[model samples]
Target: MPAPAHRLGLGLAAIARPAYITSGRAGELGDDRDVATLRDRSRALLDAAYAAGVRYLDVARSYGRAEEFLAGWLADRPGVTGGEDPVEIGSKWGYRYVGGWRTDADTHEVKDHSLDAFTEQYALSRELLGDHLGTYHVHSATLDTGVLDDGRVHRAMAHLRDRGIRVGISTSGPAQADAVRRALDVRVDGEPLFTSFQSTWNPLEPSVGPALAEAADAGARVIVKEVFANGRLAPGGEDGTEGARAAAALAARTGVPLDRIAVAAALANPWAWRVLLGPVGTDQLASNLAGAELTLPADAAEELTALAEPAEHYWATRSARPWS
Candidate 1:
């Protein structure tokens, strides 16, 4: 009689340190405090995240102060602090630092995922994410000829795995996630890399539907990020009523809100092994966790599917790039 692995994972996504309440940057996470200063705040957040049952911690090298801050706090802690509350943590590399200053505050940062960059970056991830680093990604790059040709990247990854690290890719698009899955299916030599794939999948795009199913069928673990349509599904602001209904109805049974409705919907995908979430503050975390505690009835699930349809327009245009 054991709890399921998915049940144990917290559906937590460690976004680029919440730099601006946006995906764009990691500087907004918080000003780099002089070690001792930010230390307490970082500890509090991670502590709360742990206590709340968050098992997955997602991060990236390009995420400004995020990885550095995490390395600051987590480097010394052992995995499985409490025996019963087990966890799996993941991080991504492949972006270069080159003196390390804040990138554009508004423009989204980039993911390199090249072998030369990824090799060094993975070293940094090892220092920062500790035992929580379950999966490593070739972060954010679309498929490239370089991915296959980089013997150094492959060798570096093999080195890490020989040291007991699990390696994978952080695909930028639904199509890319599929490509990673395909690669994993045929990987029979050396390290036997990447048992997981982390990608964006939710009600809005639903583009990940087939890829997720395929990944699951391939037995590659699927970790879904952005379950809330990047915050559109939440119940604040002048919008989200229709979105709220499905959640509210589901909440009739679970007592949470649209947040849980979204989580339930993502979980309903069966192909989804875990739903990773990002929260701005403590109150938001409580609400999301509360939602996590409930299950949606069949009717509620269908209603939720219809509710999410409108979410398609929430971010109609990535406007500049990778959006739209």
Candidate 2:
């Protein structure tokens, strides 16, 4: 069966539903794992997201300490879920397991979007995700990655559809939008492929937004990522700052936090069916949810758009560094 449209909107999910670890690798913070301890922390994260009315869970085979943690704590998430119908979990395939642990030691992951690898990995992910599955995507996809074009992604995706799952592509480029459009041309369970997709679409980086609009126009539901610009929207840190004052202004005018407006701007786009979110802590999820109110008074939206765009049109030419 197809996923319900009601699942869109404020119902978007937060990625990597757990705290530590990649799929089987070490956690990002490299915390040593005791299944019991992780189970406790994972439950707390999911519980908070659930209580906040989140209905989607986005995970990847490469999220480090996240997917396996979710699988282990699957049944135990009620403490954090707060009695809601279990969340709609969406995990990705297309990478070698590397022993199913979070590849924590490495700051960046290697890309492997091959067919056989994707097929094999997805099968196992299904076993881990079980019944709560709603969407499955290509993890960390780039335009050059063959995952979308390869027969294997579709084959494995087709297999998942046979099992009654909805499949989509997770992309890092505008070209993936084209791939999604192409993927939708084929028949999988009588429905076109890539019913849903995730991509980075924050205001500071508007390159993918138009592509996403094209996808939505073509019938696929688009889920936006990095609405916070991956921490760049926060009070400036390592990266350069361009939109802080504008971000702060929007926050003050709307009574929404700067962090919330980062997300709210993405949510305000009619083409975006849902926006994927991530919070480091349980309370952070609440702050992220503040964006879900989905209200962007017309002037606020315009100013925020202006804030995101610079005099030169993009921030690269500006004298300032990127916002952390």
Candidate 1 on 1-324: residue-level lDDT in tens? Answer: 123223323322333332333332232244453335444555565666777666666666765556666655455565544466555667777664332342334444554656667757766777666666767776653456466345566677766676666776666543555566555643425535666677766655566567668777867778777676655555441133455445545555755577766676677777777777666445666666665656777776666666544323433422222310
TM-score of each: 0.75, 0.75
Find the candidate with the highest lDDT and give its number.
2
lDDT of candidate 2 over 110-148, digit per residue (tens): 467777667677667767766666788877665576565
Clash tally, candidates in order: 7, 20
Q: Where does model 2 exceed 4 Å of error?
A: 1-39, 77-86, 96-107, 174-176, 186-191, 235-238, 252-255, 308-324
Question: In candidate 2, how many Å is residue 217 off?
Answer: 3.8
lDDT of 1 at 109: 53
- Give me the displacement of residue 115 in model 2, in angstroms: 1.8
**How far is 296's C-alpha from truth in model 2 (Å)?**
2.3
The segments of candidate 1 whose C-alpha lies over 4 angstroms from its true place after superposition are 1-41, 75-86, 96-108, 130-132, 144-152, 174-177, 186-192, 237-256, 307-324
